[model samples]
Target: MEKQILDFSLVPLGLCLLLAYHIWLLHRIIKHPTSTILGINGVNRQVWVRTMMEDVSKNGILAVQTLRNNIMASTVLASTAIMLSSVLSIIMANSKARPSEIVLGAESELGFWIKFLSILVCFLMAFLFNIQCIRYYSHASMLINVPVKKMSSSHLRAEYVKRTVNRGSCFWSLGLRAFYFSLPLFFWLFGPIPMFLCCVVLVFMLYFLDVTFDYGGVVDEEEEW
Candidate 1:
């Protein structure tokens, strides 16, 4: 009964905490673009795209190479996520239906399935987001190589290319977030106490990493996007 109470209460509380942090982060990114790392990186990415598009003849190779690197990274992450998801599903499927007291959470079979399913969902989401990241990066790679004249002469615009690259990056960031979310879920298997503690620590760590305090010193010369 005590373990079940911990599972029911702490698990939901931890999940809510993670959700609230992301909601706040989205608000910060939207309201004050320079305040967060994502916003600041987005500004620089736009500048990079503009610079690359300005002289496609000179920077085309560099742009393609850079985007290729991003694509490879996303590919690796997507593959890892899917592989983990598959392995977890297999473990869940093969495991006996009997409820065991060894788990730190609820002793019920339903609780065991819920915990596994939550972690599996996180991995699946990471895979899907990384796949989307690869798709956008591939599109941007081709678009970035288009000569300046042809780019302007057609419906395709530099802004569109910039948006594509940013969208890919956005997906990449989301995939990473999904991985981050899995950390606490993984701890939930040990017990709800560890999961709750992990959530608190993860939130604090992410807050420091996501918000920028040195923006003025590092990007002083760059114009606001």
Candidate 2:
């Protein structure tokens, strides 16, 4: 038996927000310059643009694959949680039932429902990831093949140099990295109340690494694809 659950209402909102954020990112990637001029304070010099469209398209494909993987992982996670939660709910719902009643029927029903809900959420999430994967991969491939100058970076090939604002795979890889940090949603379960508070420490750590400026010169060898 399903009880009144507040989290159900949140699913739609969370999905919408994630969709909007990704859509916005895809738009910016397709429209914006390869190396954005960061007007940080006043010391704004041109930064190096890494990975032209070809590289980015490859990344997008991988991102699509990663989304597919996430769908599977989250499916397991959500199913387990939902099933357990539902079982607890069932036990509470039939408080009047004797211990035998709870043991014989209530537990089994709750477990079944939880597994079903898990599959449902997993299916939805998998569909969403697959759609985005195809859309992004198509965008990236088309952009890479197009002959247009999207940036002024002389380091890239003449063919790629002419083109600017084409879909690249870097965005997807970065997105994947971001997702990895969130795998299993530990932060949501037991972390700080506000994200800002936790991120402050992380931001400082990232900033310190950024300032270190460690690097090896770009090795322009043909990748063994």
Candidate 3:
């Protein structure tokens, strides 16, 4: 029994380490976006928007359409997050509805509920961040195509538009990260071993998804602008 306890303890320890590593990586990306794939993509996106805004004569139509698409996409994600949160809350409220028992054939009530709560938090955060993303996007859409004049106000509006869109993108990325984190938590309901393995796999998947091929080129161009 001692040995079994020791083995089980390692599972939570490994999970904690994995979560810490994930958080550290995100912090690094935020601090130095050009160093990571996802960060680089974000930089590129900002550059693209700024470039389009600077040359409204040639890109005005495309910019408006892109912002509209972004708003639509954010809306869909927000709705999905809300639905998932609702479902999870209902499941969590039912004491007898243990996921471990249903999915893993285990009678570990405590572990099952813990896992459920983790998943629930992920969905709730995703929902909240997605709503914020939608708010920024909505505000950005109105400013993105505003008529450019030789006035200082026009330049300020352009700057605000870029900042708003960038903020929206950040929130959207965070919502997606919450979704990614939930995958491992869901597998955790089955067993710690699977959870650990899923965490490793998720790190690899996120690394690939977040890293961009353009490197620091986009960031450099934005700086020059």
Candidate 4:
């Protein structure tokens, strides 16, 4: 019995360490975007956006259209997060609902409920952050299309637009991160062992996906649609 307790204790400890490491990695990438693929892509995206703004004609049609696309994407993510949060809330409130045999084997009632609540919180946070992202995007849409002469004031306005867009992008990234974090929580339903393994795999996958490799002084700045 003592051995079982010791083994079980490792599960929560592992999970805590995994989460801490993930946060630290994200902070490092954001602080030094040149070191990672995703972060570098984010920097390149801002540069491209700034260039487009500079190239915009007096009518600013191109900037307006680009912001419209950003708004649409943020709207979709926000809507999805809201819907998932609602579904999770219903599932958590229903006491009669039992864990599925496929995902959950012998989890205690309290443990299962706690996991469900954690998942629910993730979706809720995603929803809130996405909504905030939409707000920033919407505000930037107006600012990006504002008429400005080619002067210092215009440069300041352009800088403001870039800052707003970057803030919105950060919020969008956070929302997506919440979604990613929830994946291992879902696997935790099966067992702590599965959850631990999934967390390890997730960290490795994220590292590869996020890290950048440069070759021959070539920088890939193409944004995928």
Candidate 5:
């Protein structure tokens, strides 16, 4: 038997796996040598650019470049996906039964366009998310190249403090990451409460992830894209 989206178990199982994966991945980064995936030296690096690159697992200009690529991919795919979704909405709006009609007259243009849009949206969304992941990976890379000369005890201690704050981002980014792979349940729109909550939570996650790391450290001077 083929599985259908209407089947109840699949959604929960998928979310559970996603949640668990994020929890585990966070644990790994927190315990890593840099307390981040990309190696940026916090000691002498500039704060803002370093932070951005480190978040992407890239350093300096490289991270921005990575972001540029991601933005492009996301724009293309997201636009296409939205277009498809819009078309589908248009379709469901115009469906009318024509049981008496034969052959070419049977299928309505409205229904076909709607179905086609829904399918096209699915493809676009998938591609968009794939490139988004590179965003996180490049951020992690920014932390991979720190030059460890002696820093004041205070600076080192701050690093630990920063790590604790970054943990929250870990959870949030992981959740946002989940959206990349999670099925686009368009019907969920009917239940406004849940969908709104999910979006709110995601926004909070990205916000925390950004703020937590923004001031803490910078990538090494030598490390540029």
Candidate 6:
């Protein structure tokens, strides 16, 4: 009963804390585009797209190479996520470990399955997001090379390409975020206290990593885009 109580009390609270932090981060990204790393990266990607579109003949190869690198990165992460998910699925199917030994929740089987499923979901989400990232990055690779004036229509304009690139980046960030979230879920298998503590520590680390105070110092204005 004590273990069950701890699980009930701590698990939801930890999850809510994580969800709240992301909500706050999203609000900041929307309202202050220059304040967060994601917003700043979006701005820079747009500038990069515009610059590449200006002289496609000269920048075409460079643009392709850059997009290729991004695609490779997404591919690697996607592969890793899917592999982990597969391993987890296998373990869940074959596992006979006593709940008394491994899990600390109410119903041992139920708690055990819940933890496995949560971790599995996280990896699956990461895989899906990275696949989306690859999709967008692949589309942007070709779109970025099109001459800006040639695509005069609004939908076909450089803005569309910028949006595509940024979307890929956004997916990449989301995939990474899913991987980050898995850390807490993994800890939850040990106990609720560890899970909650991990969530607090992870949020604190992410705040520093995701938000920026010295945007100008970080990105040199003198460097031509």
Q: What is candidate 6's TM-score against the reference?
A: 0.90
lDDT (C-alpha, whole model) for all candidates = 0.87, 0.36, 0.74, 0.72, 0.41, 0.86
Tens digit of lDDT per residue, candidate 2, span 120-207?
A: 4443344344334444444434444333356555346423422221112332334332443333122222212222233444444433
Better structure of 1 and 6 per lDDT: 1
Q: Residue pairs in steric clash, candidate 4? A: none
Count clashes in each candidate, considering only residues at least 3 apart in sequence or on different chains.
0, 11, 5, 0, 22, 0
* Candidate with better lDDT, 1 vs 2: 1
Q: List TM-scores for all candidates, in order.
A: 0.91, 0.27, 0.81, 0.81, 0.32, 0.90
Positional deviation of residue 64's Cα in model 3 after best superposition, in angstroms = 2.1
Q: Per TM-score, what order, best first? A: 1, 6, 4, 3, 5, 2
Ranking by lDDT: 1, 6, 3, 4, 5, 2
Per-residue CA lDDT of model 1 for 32-59, tens digit only, reads 7788899898988988998988887899
Best by lDDT: 1
Candidate 3 or 1, higher TM-score: 1
**lDDT against true structure, model 2:** 0.36
- Tens-place lDDT per residue, model 5, 55-146, is 33345456446445644554555455556557655554554733223112213454344434544455455544544444443443343233
lDDT of 3 by residue, 1-225 (tens): 553463387567756766787787777676656767666656667677778888788888888788788878878888898899898888777778546646573446666667678888898899898889988888877677666774568767766776788889889988988988788788766666777788787777766766654554235544321
Flag the better candidate by lDDT, 2 or 4: 4
Note the residue pairs that clash in candidate 3. 37-210, 37-211, 37-212, 38-210, 38-211
Compose the digit string of candidate 4's lDDT tens values, residues 82-168: 899888877777767665532365456667677788888888888888888989988987777665663458767877777788788
Off by over 4 Å in 6: 95-107, 148-150, 154-156, 216-225
lDDT tens string, model 6, 1-225?
Answer: 787788889989999999999999998777676778887877788788878887889999999999999999999999999999999998788757675565554266877788989999999999999999999999998887776566558445777788888889999999999999999999998889999999999999999998997674244442211
Could you tell me which residue pairs clash in candidate 6? none
RMSD to the native, candidate 3? 3.3
